[model samples]
Target: MENATTLQLDPEANSNQTIDSQEKILTGDRATGSLHLGHFVGSLQQRVQLQYRYAQTILVADMQGLTDNGHNPQKISANILNVVADYLAVGIDPLKTTICLQSAIPALAELTMYYANLVSIARLERNPTVKNEIKSKSFGRSIPAGFLTYPISQAADITAFKATLVPVGEDQLPMLEQTNEIVRRLNHIAQQDILVECKPLLSKVSRLPSVDGKSKMSKSMGNTIMLSASEKEISKAIKAMYTDSSHLRVSDKGQVEGNVVFTYLDAFHQDQDYVANLKEQYTAGGLGDGSIKKILDECLQELLKPIRQSREKFIADPSQLIAILKEGTERSNDESNDVLAQVKKAFGLNLF
Candidate 1:
């Protein structure tokens, strides 16, 4: 109902839709953090819609979790169920979408180890995300080995599922490129199309900035509004949101150029005409950030109400939720194993 989501356009939206292409997709989040508005607007929102349309697979990346936060294993483990809860809390149906725990599959680790050799230390060093995160986290001298090798691990995550399309933000373009490089090398060496080249499924709105006006919204930064938040919680969070550098006085003409509230409205609010009207009002010197935030809050509450209720329903019966996840994991393994077998044979690993 909120615009035509990826699910709407995906051919796997229904059983009746053609299953012609092996466009099996693998995408997911690191259970290292909470699900935020940024996650929804950027990836999960599209994913929820896309799953119905494509042969979609949603992975709970606990293995990737350990790569960086291996010491915080329990923290990562606790978030697993919470992350899945958030997934189902959205529209990611377990029956239609394969939701697997990444740590549960040993084949992925094996594949990752193999792909690791194909990449160069220089290539990994050039990865923008790795560089940024390492500097930000101040891991200059103490970088973990897994942290350095995450790009290869990501390639395994994508190829193990034989995902033809990988939904990533622009920041992740390098990672997708890395995965395709492996695919090319493997396919060429084997004299067969053992791996499929993946494309970046960048959404028109690629990412949501943090509410505090940082480059990206992050859980650790404390600038997020969770999809499962109550109306009161959402309102409180919006009221406390940071705005532009100027606009100190009530009557001072405010700039909507980087206002978090307006940004959120533009990304999440579907009433385009209303958004346009609000933008005009704010720019023309009549609208207050408070006024805009009020409407934004209402729109967000309407969006979150159903989701919160759905989350509550799922929480009421934990066993049913586990069963759904187990079913999805089983289905995912069946398909991923086929891709793994092909990769192993191409590398002559099956000779053993």
Candidate 2:
């Protein structure tokens, strides 16, 4: 068995590495809402590039979406297909990358039930990601147990496929850390490597800030540009984006440090030199926020045009989307059930 250590992969350097066709990657999104530009920059784009090189599976985690929204179960159910559409729109080929619905996979829930025993409430509370989420959600004394233990659920999602690589953002590193802890503990109890430890394939791009610039781009906050955003919506979002508050006029010097427009340009604009030149002009007191916003608007409009069209086409044919999910979920069921059997045997629960 390999040493239990986390290996980080720089997405920029991924092309230079030798292709490992056998490597299995498991990455996905919560089925709470449609994906956005932040999703593209953070992980969806990487998934598109990786599917051709590795055996990848994207899990639409509806069960995880229920952690906090359990009171509103309809929200999760309504968006499962929307999330899958966004994945397809963003170029994650369903044939190359298996796209599975989480609720459909019974083994995952079974695995989560078993793995929950390996993790403790104190350790779950101490997790940095969970801590931040709890504070931000203001759950107060009403924290949901499912919400707190979703990391263990996440571990089940990863290990059931024996996924060796998981694409994640920096904020999610703690979740992976806790996953490895569970993997190691279970293996230790089994006295062998029945479950394989996974590594984090961190995104090279930083998390995109919300248009309001007060927080990270999030769907629940209504501060993000969705993948299926129309051209008019894109332009409107760029116009309202937070930029230098002090630059009241075109001739006034602008600060680019916290400007959301420049940040989007840096992430989306293909020409870095052009963005740098624009930044220089803005800081030197000549460029206007409108001019730069126009540039960003144009860039995003072109970028999202095809994605919007693709998403719309998929949405028009619900049967196709259902077929894709059904096929992928069936495949996932077989694989995850095999892993659950091994885990059950490890726990001496395979009495039958």
Candidate 3:
């Protein structure tokens, strides 16, 4: 909707358009911890589907992680490989999707510094995601400047790769808005159409609520089932899942609304008929939460078994894992440095 470029549409043309071969997509997760089921449903699954259709670049955003976890470099460092393993385990083919480390790309940091001036502190303060995170972390008056400005960094990341598509949840809409604002401003100022605008590929299953039936799934809240969670852990988490609190007995009428187990089944299970029947039986006053939980546990265990196995195999080879990251990082540098050089030349900073 926010436009720096215009599209010339033919009045008689067909509505459907073919995807461009050169179109690129960029997506990533902060390397603060291992990914969980929420990540799978929200973005990773979409990435797998998009890999062959577009040139995809997946970043392990360690620099962004430092915005919040600056005090714990060890945690960020350890989780880098874990996140990459999660990507591979979930069928992200490295040959098709370039997986890179954010810290290894110096061009991104430089771009961030330049782009920061294009955005105002007042605008950053108004960002809903940043505001929500500040409240969640209770940063009241001690909010880190880096955390507040990470949106600029994110804008830089997207434009550095000239990404045309970004997979994100509904809550991240504000962030994409900010990114496009900067993109349009930069291209206008340079008067040369330098940067590209990106569209958000909103996930169908945008979010999965917390296991305890809270508003969202979060690792910090201890309500997430890790992508590589053991069968035992999956069993325990599913068994402890929140259900209708009023249904105290097996014969008591249960409410399907706001039930966590059914929510998960709706997301993960392909057998819609069975899930529908389960919901119908659940509300009919004779079904028990334990029986529903057992079904969910088995479904989850079977779903995650291969993912856990693949993760373990990747983790066993530290050198090979590092090599993959290093290669991807090098490729990122080549791509981003070209963009950075163009940006510097546009600003008259490349006066050599």
Candidate 4:
């Protein structure tokens, strides 16, 4: 809720540099797996629009993916390109948005080390996001230190890019809050605003539920519809989506609230008036689950057709993906290293 304007940059220290007046955006996803429809409605769609309006940078956070998957590094390594492909498939232009790899940017790791000192273990343990993840992952007694401290790493990611806006869900507000805390602390220590505070740009659309309708859409849960799902796969997932169990007959009045079929229709079906009519008919006891499922199947197939095609093209040429990532990372490295220099200068680490 606090404004980023309160944090001031020391003019004398940054006098030679022409400050970028454009609002810089930093957002990303871990490379644990391919992105899903939940991503499409939630953040990916927003990122596509943001690229055209602002200075946007998408970080493929391969390093952060290792936090909980330290035992299975291959999963993270394998999906890095797949994730980038999904971005391109969804309309994120590499020419407009700089897409970089996290591990490729050494300054992020270095910044994480410096930012970690500003936060305490007790403070990290208290973060709501960290606590919930620990419980969900069932890390009970043997939590990975990296898993516990990745929030600090995230703070490093945001600050290193001097990001002014970060797209996040409501649940992720805490992470942005923590990022600002570190930025404020580092500036206090330096007696100058070497780091810029960032604010959360909350998504307007609600998160899409998994097909089961009982859980959040997640690849790890195998309950999500992937952006790159084949036609048959999408159809199969829609067929299995949870609907009002009590609506046993086409004439039986259905409950639209918890029906996953209706949920997907609301998100994917472009014609709201048509979807609304369907919902009304279904709720009034004249509609069947199969009818809505059929409609949803059509909608999803149409939505994903082009995305899947684009993703396949990018996936086929791994070198092109690599080249785009390399160029973005190189550009990002220059920007982040400059910020890192200022941070180190504040810490009096620039002995040379």
Candidate 5:
């Protein structure tokens, strides 16, 4: 695998910046739908590793989900437990990682409202992430105000935890900028620094392509194989996965680049010798798409089988699952309360 570009942070620019020796990390998924393999390879696996090293907090971002799914609030509620199950299934330890719901934390909402006033409408419009999402969702004229200003809410999520490290993909780089911008502005206005600036922890295996070789693998695109997909579902998705269209016959040369099967293998398969030999054969000819897809299917099933079993165990005990989230929500609220109080004091709103 090739090395990815490194992310840089500006520590000297803000003399008020302070970092805890044990760096705290805050990351999460939107409860808009069940997570898929893209989530696994991209962030879930990395979160599991970061738990042992940092004070980790995972959020089921239902409030953020409501930004786009405002008309369908039921969808967000329905998937909350599913997202929790997926997190535990993928080895996110409850003891080591705090798993909380965004809406359950009142401080987050309060912080967002305060931070929203710090950022201007023109600056929000210039945010690359917001612009890109607006275009992607085709919300041209009717873009939701919440969706446009999600970056501010996101800043609250990070700072409320005092998180110093945030795991993000390349596309989300601008979000970190927006967050730090708010922090800087607040510190400058109040004549005291209240919020801590965060740095981006770029994922090694960034974005995964859709099974149909589309730009990204997303549930909305109908191109994803869910993390909890059954053997039959996995088989169906693999059969439909896109391959080199120019490779007419088994004997014809094929292009490995942009091929979804090989992409999956690169991300999931561990055997270097086997993958190298297969790639050679695939490029030279004789190997077929069916054979490649079969290998990918088997690899995915093997990877997900244990995750599926773990998810089922948690799902079977719904009360225990809810209890876990409630516990985390309580812990997270306690942590954020201090930050919110400080913000209020800075703005002279703590007079009461």
Candidate 6:
């Protein structure tokens, strides 16, 4: 079996791997914040494995952040490379994965403009994904045009590369449906197949809870373990972690349910017996939160030590990291342009 590092994406090549229905998978996250342990468990873990199994395109969604956070270009800019750092640290082998910046490509925006007219304005309002995001961001009354049309842009992102699989959590199934809607409409209107239908691959774990036991871990909540955090920083974050609410003392039996510590163990630690033993001790009493935290510290350190080291190395020579990003964006543009050309031809908007 060949390593993912040996695979390559050459846009100019004639004899490359087949671009079959199973060739590509596209997915990614926003770079508006630091990545956390939840990111590792829920998404990055799958990305590392899929690199070998499929042609993956990981888009750093910097442009999407601007829809609501338009005033904070600096915020998105600051975290762009940091997110790339996280991706590289998590072992997203650059050779197999096209780690692209969404904002760097104009072709995608063009595709979005073309598809936007194909769908009704009323249909855009009914898109479940866009509606949820609008509500979540409290944009009910004053939604940005870009915010309302994000699904169109997403369709552009996926169809521009002819992505076949988009790994999204269950909550994001609507976005996949919207993208397929555009694909169906575009093909039907053109009387030719200009795009491919994409299937959803929800995360195995779906989402991870925050250290504060929040249903979702987010950097905004400050209950996250930053991937680049040092050992002392990781320790500090773990010490501040929320524990069982009922167990006020070491002598009291602790409830494992809704306990962030145990949940962390479940998500990060695969040693079921060890976790079970710890849970039993915790449930019966005499197992202090400190003890459990110490166990978590050790486990997380083992997981993060290598990644932290890699991050430090990448951070030391950011120019080289930027070079990789530039190369990736350039390669992605070539592919995007090729697909865009086909789409324009389908619409009879191009000649010669």
Best by lDDT: 4
lDDT of 6 by residue, 1-352 (tens): 0111222223243324443445688888877887888889878877777776778999999998787788778879898888888899989979988899899988999899899888788988997778787888888869988889888899999998888778776677777888888999989977888788888765557466777776467777778888887899889888988888789999999999888888888888859799999999999999999999999999999999999999888878889788888888999899998888888877888977
Per-residue lDDT of model 1, residues 49-151, tens digit only? 6765677888899988887788879879878877888889988878778889888777788888888878899899888888988898799858999988899
Instruction: Tally clashing residue pairs in candidate 3.
Output: 0
Error of 6 at 255 (Å): 0.9
TM-score quality measure for candidate 2: 0.94
Stretches of model 2 off by over 4 angstroms after superposition? 1-19
lDDT of 3 by residue, 92-134 (tens): 9888789999999999999999899889999999999999999
Q: After superposition, how far is residue 261 of candidate 3 from its true place, in Å?
A: 0.7
Candidate 6 regions with alpha-carbon error over 4 angstroms: 1-21
In terms of TM-score, how similar is model 1 to the real structure? 0.90
lDDT of 2 by residue, 205-255 (tens): 777899999986877777889998888888888888999999999999999
lDDT of 4 by residue, 1-352 (tens): 6543322212233224443566889999999999999999888887877776678899999999999999999999999999999999999989989999999999999999999888999999999999999999899769999999999999999998999988887788889899999999999988999898888876668789899988878887879999999999999999899999899999999999989998888888889999999999998999989999999999999999999999999999999999999999999999999999999999999998
Score every model by TM-score.
Answer: 0.90, 0.94, 0.93, 0.94, 0.93, 0.91
Clashes of each: 7, 0, 0, 0, 0, 0
lDDT of 5 by residue, 200-315 (tens): 88765658889899767878787998988888988998898888999889899998998888988988886867977889999999999989988988898999899988988998
Q: In terms of TM-score, how similar is model 4 to the real structure?
A: 0.94
- Compute the lDDT of residue 329 as modeled in candidate 1: 77
The all-Cα superposition gives candidate 1 an RMSD in Å to the true structure of 3.9
Question: How well does candidate 6 score on lDDT at residue 138?
Answer: 88
Give the distance in Å from residue 17's predicted Cα in candidate 4 to where it truly belongs. 26
